[model samples]
Target chain A: MYSNDGFRELERHECLRLLAKVPVGRIVHTRQALPAVLPVNFSLDHDGAVLLRTSAASELVRAIDGSVVAFEADEVDALTHSGWSVVVTGSATVVTDPAEHERLTRTGPSSWVPSPQEVFVRVEPELVTGRELVGGRSLYGVDLTGAT
Target chain B: MYSNDGFRELERHECLRLLAKVPVGRIVHTRQALPAVLPVNFSLDHDGAVLLRTSAASELVRAIDGSVVAFEADEVDALTHSGWSVVVTGSATVVTDPAEHERLTRTGPSSWVPSPQEVFVRVEPELVTGRELVGGRSLYGVDLTGAT
Candidate 1:
């Protein structure tokens, strides 16, 4: 839906599609009553669940083992002054099933850290929303009247 | 301080230094009871306070006003598999003084959104921590034995 200003509010399917284009995003989880954000590499499962790998000793694994968390990703073009950001808020559950864990261990998202990513956490989306900057000056066809 | 793995825990000053290098970061704040993360453009003051401008009607502006939040920024070389991420946890306060607000309004971080960024939020650092992936096989003289 086109929201007020030049921002286009995207639907759930389009949000997931945009997320699939970005490999890295930040996971936000509450710790000690304060929100913490950490960057992670992720992949989407067949059901659109977000798959991630983290070390057993990592703080993120500890905070989001079985909690509601938010994941966000975006792409911005500085030259064109346009970009899109997607947010998926869902329940994060650690993968404990042996067979499932092993499968995820074999085909999980790649980690930038060299540490052994033994913990597999899956975020099942409860809500997904996205917005793209539109109506900006660009080579792409965007109606600039919506520019905020 | 060094951690159990090849990740080097950076000092507070070093964390601030890394944050200065990046113009964009994600702000993690609580909306209702769940944590949310939003990408933002920010600038650091000499005292290390993060300054940002957002539209008056933006959700981030509403959620972060007079609240505690976290800001994170990172850089990773995909091919080299080396990168550093820094997180700054702070209390966000809207700039109220007209003179100060106007000064910040004039000199605050630039926004990619074409909207009128009238609200200025300043995050004063409370906790700063960073980690750098080290010891990877690279021509950049990384200490590889420390690679996790």
Candidate 2:
């Protein structure tokens, strides 16, 4: 659903169908020169990669110290404003596999309450775009799987 | 405005007046161990420190690379349920003095439509905390400098 020169293009199964209904997102970059945004709790791996975990000293990891990133995820409904978003520009490495770190330590840990240190992050998405506002000002787009 | 463990103890102008009133936040950390969260656009520096910016190989610089970090910012308001939050665990350097980085550059270049490769992040809170939620239950806290 992209055709206006603004190019919406967001495929890859609609970016896994709007990133499987948002668990929270916002991971913009640039840390010492100014723009740094963070809000995590993401999981879209099964190959769709976008897993994240925190602590072990976090400025969201000194503003992306592995470079090359632009991860974004969205879901809106400010009372029916309608929404959908997925933007994942690539190259954010740092997941030295040891059987994928024991399958991310058997996947069962995410806390923001008192303490939950010991870091982890993996977002390997070359490029993916999306947008679907519909009914708050309409702006459509789809099939942007890095041009497939 | 706190009582639920009082945000684990907060101070630094009550964490910069709950970070001026959180428009939105999330900047958890950890890049090598995996956990990471990002979604930021912040304010609260007049020596209260917590600026923003990133780039130069991101991962928040591999989780605040030279270490001693843990910065957090929060906001909530499920509608009239009000909201307020602030967390700055302190010490996450990398500013490379350029007249103090052009005196903490800010004022323009973001309405949240960025993607030119982004860069900039500067958080130095030392230890700030906050809590506030009126109506959606109840939780109040203060102490960025006001103390409560």
Interface RMSD of 2: 15.2
Sorted into a CAPRI-style docking class, model 1 comes out as acceptable
Candidate 1 lDDT over residue span A1-148, tens digit each: 6654666877778888988887777777777777777666788876778888777666666778889998888775555666787888899998989999888767777555546446778998777777777635221122211111
DockQ of each: 0.29, 0.02
Stretches > 4 Å off in candidate 2: A1-20, A38-148, B1-13, B16-65, B68-70, B78-82, B85-89, B92-124, B127-148
Tens-digit lDDT track of model 2 for A78-130: 34434555667666655666677567757722433323444557777766666
Each model's total of backbone clashes: 5, 82
Give all TM-scores, in the order shown: 0.83, 0.27
Scoring model 2 with DockQ, what do you get? 0.02
CAPRI band for model 2: incorrect
